[model samples]
Target: MTDASGRIALLRATIVVVAAGGLRALTYRAVAAEAGVSHGLVRHHFGTRDQLVAEAMEFAIDESLRGSNMLEQGLTASEFAAGIESLADRESALQSFQYELLLESRRRPELTPLAERHYGAYREAIERQLGRLGVADPALVDLIWFALDGLVFTQLVAPADPAPALARIRSLVESAAA
Candidate 1:
């Protein structure tokens, strides 16, 4: 493989390992095994486990955000909910890995800033959406975001059909708009 392709393969492998095993459980050998590369190659690319975790976390967040297309114009609550549901269906481990890193950040101060920055992007997107809907308060953004987060978490843990819950959330948001 070319250098770029090799790097891409390693990065993909890193994401799978971290998503499947969490940051604490990640190992160079595991990443190599997932990537079909050597452990030395994994270490050469990432240097350390922390670097690997940071890159993988960032990649996961970027990929999820990209898949959601949340910044597109004329977004609706139902559409947003559908995006969430699609994420749950397609990349369940993405959310779990993100939450795992977030919780783990509480114990690792160095990770706090990265987690906050990643989460801030989601918050900012929601805030923009709420703002477009004529809701200006930051608190309301927080509330709406928390509601969405709760839905995602519950879906992850309990594995339920999210349509009804998402509909209820859309109703509540719409009612609040009135």
Candidate 2:
């Protein structure tokens, strides 16, 4: 593999390890083993476990957002809701990994800023989506985003079918515009 491909592969492996094991259990050797590369490769790429964990966390957030279509434009309500379900289905450990990092931040103050910044992306995306739907009130974005978040969180723990709740949210947004 080329340098870029190799780097991507390594990063992907790091994300899997971090997602499966959490930051507390992460080690360079473990990442390397998971990636099928040498431990020195992981060390050379990331320099330290802290750096690896940080990058992995960022990667997870970005991947989750991308997979969920949170950054896409002109999404219908069904599309948006389907995106949420797809994320939960495809990236099963993603939410758990995110929550793990969030809780870990309490003990590792240095991680707090990273966690906040990562979540800010989600909020910004929700705000943009609301804006696209012609919802003028900023507070509405918060309420809708939190409600959607609650739906996603509950789905993660209970594994429910999301179509009904999603349709209701869609109706709510439509009614708000009407």
- lDDT, candidate 2, 1-178, per-residue tens: 8887777777788767766777756787887898899999988988888787787778778888887777999877555545544355677677667777887998999999878977787889877776776767778677767776677677667878878877776666667655
Can you give the TM-score per candidate against the true fold?
Answer: 0.83, 0.86
RMSD of 2: 2.2
TM for candidate 2 is 0.86
Worst 10 residues of 2 by lDDT: 78-87
The clash count of every prediction, one per candidate, is: 0, 0
lDDT of each: 0.74, 0.74
**Candidate 1 lDDT tens digits, 32-140:** 8998988999888879888877877877777777767566668665555445443566677777778778888999999997799777987888777666666687886
Task: Enumerate residue pairs that collide in model 2.
Answer: none
lDDT at residue 126 of model 1 (Cα atoms): 74
Q: Name the regions of candidate 2 deviating beyond 4 angstroms.
A: 76-86
Error of 1 at 135 (Å): 3.1
